[model samples]
Target: MKIAIIDDNSFLISSIKEKLSFFEEIQVKYTANNGADLLEKLDKDHNLDALLMDIEMPVLNGIETTLAVKQKYPQIKIIMLTVFDNDENIFNAIKAGADGYLLKDVNPHELFNGIVDTLNGGAAMNPSIALKTLKLLRNPVDFKDVSKEEINLTNREVEVLEQLSKGLSYKVIADNLFLSPSTVRKHIENIYSKLQVHSKLEAVQKARRNNLI
Candidate 1:
């Protein structure tokens, strides 16, 4: 029944701790502010049985942390405790090897049950999340599409990429967009750097592949 809590918000950490305090079987081992902190702490002392992980965090997020932790400590169970119930977040967390998914506002009894169920080799998902998981199974979301946010290209950059994808020359692109040729060239250079490509064709291809254009 030893567990660790990882969250960026100190108040939420305290709240989770308070909820678990009612259960004598659950021992709160340590608290971490983010995934990096959690990893560092685990490196020092990884004698815990499970973790209550928060999704949105600084440095490293819950999903990334879960993947890392599971790779290193396969025996340690991980339960995602977060405010988000969106399909994308839940799907990503599950894909990252989460043993359970529960909302932050879950009742103490239900939260304790989720922890126990996860530790007992059962998946624990909130009711809504469970339905979402079923739907996800029925129609799987493309993970590549889920990762498009990582690139985070600006709207103008996407517009420039779209124009470039049309095989337009830089001068023509500039004229069509009402910009100078030098500005278009600079924009293309920035796009190349952002897309990690050497040429217009590669940039366009990568952008299309990532669904950014």
Candidate 2:
């Protein structure tokens, strides 16, 4: 399988490459320091099967990058990698259209399985999502429990909004969060659905109007 990775940390990128080095079936076609770089490479060719992305970066953030990638290359799957398992980040990523979510500390084998599953038409969410779900269910929100509508958004979806408001790009955001550009996209989709809005600008506007932040 062919894959692309866009992250700022050269070391982490190398480590990931090494971890998958033994798998002859997996080929790392392109690697970039940020989302903009990934787009540059993609302009030359768009044949990647999957992307492993981070949520934060400097030039373009994971969320924005994912949004752009999904717009241009919807066929490829994206999987996010992060150290944070917060509700916002999780929801936002799902909203962005990510195929799966995995923690940085996840077992390599599990990561492998997640990658395969995502490529095979499956969704992957970090186990932490259940804890967040349980918490929300217990406490409930103050806003007439619109939480169900919000449920359509993933943790990563929230993360994307937080970042996008700051006017960050996918590449820069990915670098900050140590993820690839493609994975950043999946979360944006969830954000749209949860907010009951379409397009990035609309989602941000609605969230602001509703005081969703």
Candidate 3:
């Protein structure tokens, strides 16, 4: 399995490389200091299978990078490998199309398994991260005193947002609404732009706060 690690700290990158060095099947393709550098490298050669991305970095953060990568190369899986497991970061990473979420302290075996599972279409999340994700989905973050902005969403967009709030994937939402996945994605993009939110959690919470959903 070809993998790329992205982190601002050189020592952390080296540490992750050393951990992965235990696995014979896994190859450390390359390492980048930040998301911008990674994108430039990918533009030249994007044959990577997965990326171990750090959340906080200069030039471009992991969540923004994940969104850009998913839009450009949806085939390559991305696992957020960060030390911080806070709720905001988790939701933002998920909203940005992260395939998996793992902490930097994960054991080598667990990290390898996460990569394998993600490649096989599983949401490879650390046990704690998984629990947090479930909790966030069940009871989303509350935004107090959110501005009552008049965000105009079409009927179809509202339907899509409702499905998103239910924690449904794009494909499933498209199927349920009898729309193409691409169309659903476009609607979501519009929703994000109109609502000025970067994450599904934010969108849902704001919509509820404004009584749009």
Candidate 1 lDDT over residue span 1-213, tens digit each? 999999999999999999999999999999999999999999999999999999878799999999999999999999999977777788889888999999999999999999999999998789999999999999998866665646768877787888988888888889888989998888888989887678786677568657887
Best by lDDT: 3
Model 3, 100-129: lDDT tens digits are 999999999999999999999998899999
Candidate 3 Cα outliers beyond 4 Å, as residue runs: 142-213
Order the candidates by TM-score, highest first — what do you get? 1, 3, 2
Off by over 4 Å in 2: 130-213
Model 2 C-alpha lDDT per residue in residues 1-213, reported as the tens digit of each score: 899877888888887887778677789998988888888899998899998888766688677788888999999898887655656556666667778878767766777788888888986666776567467568754433343243334556677787777779877767766668776766666677677666666677557646665
**TM-score per candidate, chains pooled:** 0.69, 0.62, 0.67
Q: Each candidate: how many clashes? A: 0, 59, 0
Per-residue error for 123 in candidate 2, Å, reads: 1.4
Of 2 and 3, which scores higher on TM-score?
A: 3
Descending-lDDT candidate ranking: 3, 1, 2
TM-score of 3: 0.67
TM-score of decoy 1: 0.69
Question: Candidate 1's error at 76, in angstroms?
Answer: 0.3
